[model samples]
Target: MLRLAALDGQVSSWLDLFGPIVFYLIVWGLVFAGTGLFVGVFIPFITGDSLLFAAGILSAGHSGINIWVLAIGVGIAAFLGDQVGFLLGRHYGRPYLDRRTGAWVQRSIRRAEKFYTDLGWWAVVVGRFIPWGRVLVPPIAGIARMDYLKFVAANLVGALVWGVLLTVTGYFAASIPAVKSAAYVIGGAFILGAIIAGILSWRRNRAAV
Candidate 1:
């Protein structure tokens, strides 16, 4: 059953049968033990957006993993990961960030803290789409000492939406012919522009200082 669905022996029949479930188990195990957050942050940077999108494509297939189930799994993984991150920040990371007192860290943390406060738990939801926002925001929530339940609830919703959206986008992207290339070109251009703008901002700030 699993073999027929995945069509790849390397992925394993059990994986096809309970692969995603297994994945959730392993991912959460790491999170509970406090390593999964590292995986989540760097996986995006290393694999780029394609992997999450691929997961979506997998979910969309006639295979065992449906979109809703995938969404729930990913959501649970992300929430648990962030919860660990929040705990880490509350216990360890936040103290370092707070003590460093460097202007940039201060600025970043202040902005994040302010957002967390003003928006309450919803900031975690909005932060899901923000790249680096996801990385910093949970820690901010922890440092800010926001209600854990509220944070968890918001994190669950945000991760579900973001996970589903990215996967669905990947599905549609694969479906289109020219759109993939176009998306690459557009995304590349946007990144280049952001880099250039960041450089200019740095130079100007340097000059001012």
Candidate 2:
């Protein structure tokens, strides 16, 4: 009797009874939207790449929310989150940098200010793809007093592109069984890849210094 009650739980049965495709869309859509908002760019750096690849494969396999829609939703969320990050940088950036007495951050701000000055708007555009650069770029733009309109425009475009690319890659990865099986490996690789790329970029920029 107890076993039957446990087996008959409405929530479990409801989800279990639903079509797998619908389940995937609802699950991944929410995941994309929620994670996109709370975490922003970090999502891709973390579990985002694997999760997206999984979603893509599922979408390829069955009827689910259109991949384009998923991309747009996640993209918008990315835009909003980054906008918030930009605003935070614009308002609070100076105080945080000034109050914190870390040698690393100071060196970073010095380099960033120089970068922002020399490159003008491209710093925001290219920096979106860089790890710590993503966090630092917008604020640095604010600190350097780059044109508000230009900074916002670059940020919006970069965020949208970042969101869409990561989502699509996930979808593509899911399409291949071998790739799906290797998501754990791929996810780790993506993280390392981003880190390596960021370090290389930082070093190259430093060398140019």
Candidate 3:
């Protein structure tokens, strides 16, 4: 997305043309689609991580934007976006994918399937932090026929965490050093959380048996 943004200085030009509010409305839409929409299957390389981080930096000093509002609004968009993916998948997942024989399409489906198989419900949350992972988890979960209640719980937690963490880090990156490191920490936390959840689940199953 950043690369796409840099083309002919479009992002800069948009900020100049639309100012903050309208510009961010566009950002929220992109984030929603990139992370939560099934059409994201085609545009999986979107620079949402960088986009959110940059938005946070702008929110720090950019008048007319509040970090909390940005975080919550984007989070809600992300959550609803996943709902769309899940619903679509529940109704037409495999058939839809069968129609898509593009190389990227197949590869993305395989990777998303791997994540869903390996992580189960946690994939929905951890995938939010991983690119391509976020794009497909929703539909993947639906195709797997996961419980809707479980999917919603994981989606809400993932979106809120992703929204606040990146936005806040970017806000501080406006003044602080190691903004890059903060991103690493966020990614690490998601992977580690998935691992821990897996371990606990294994233990619980063993105990029940």
Candidate 4:
């Protein structure tokens, strides 16, 4: 029991040292760099979800940062990213698609086209929950020439939902003593979720084939 108590104390100390710095970086990234990176056609290595989760854990402490502010900032950043991606796709996507010469490129285009045709606005909302899908769907919508007004409506709703869901989840999870101590459990779960998502995607592709 004493050993467990000591270990817990150690974990809390480490969290104290690094958590604030991580929180600051996450806030900065969400407000600035995250927007640009998420807007790109190529999916980035780091995603907004993990950052938001960390932000939640930090907020669980005496940190003065407001959760609402973080959510709003992240929402705005994501909205802008989607807008920029849409614009880029509107301007360059078709020309790039036309000039490209590869089966993979063509397949991706077809999938996007199908997503638009089958799901329409819901595609935008659903894509927001997916990592690569979130990155690719906005541009795909632009490529398909989806109506700008409809896209904006969907984008707003999607960003709001995504931002709130992630931030709040983290905040609540961190409030639990058991959860705070085993913080790595959260990260592990995220990784497992990603792996599961990948497997499902792979199975979907194989079934389609």
| Candidate lDDT values, in order | 0.56, 0.54, 0.75, 0.62
Instruction: Find the candidate with the highest TM-score and give its number.
Output: 3
Off by over 4 Å in 2: 1-44, 47-62, 97-115, 176-209
Candidate 2 lDDT trough over 10 residues, lowest sum: 3-12
| Candidate 4 local lDDT, 1-209, one digit each (tens) | 35434433543454467674565455645433443454222323234556556566556664656667666776777788788768778888777445544675556556666665556676676666655557667777888898999999988877776666566566776667565435456545643554455456656767999
2 or 4, greater by TM-score: 4
State TM-scores per candidate: 0.55, 0.54, 0.85, 0.63
Ranking by lDDT: 3, 4, 1, 2
Model with the higher TM-score, candidate 1 or 2: 1
Best candidate according to lDDT: 3
User: What TM-score, to 2 decimals, does candidate 3 have?
Assistant: 0.85
Residue 5 lDDT (model 2)? 35
The true-structure Cα RMSD of candidate 1 reads: 9.0
TM-score of 2: 0.54
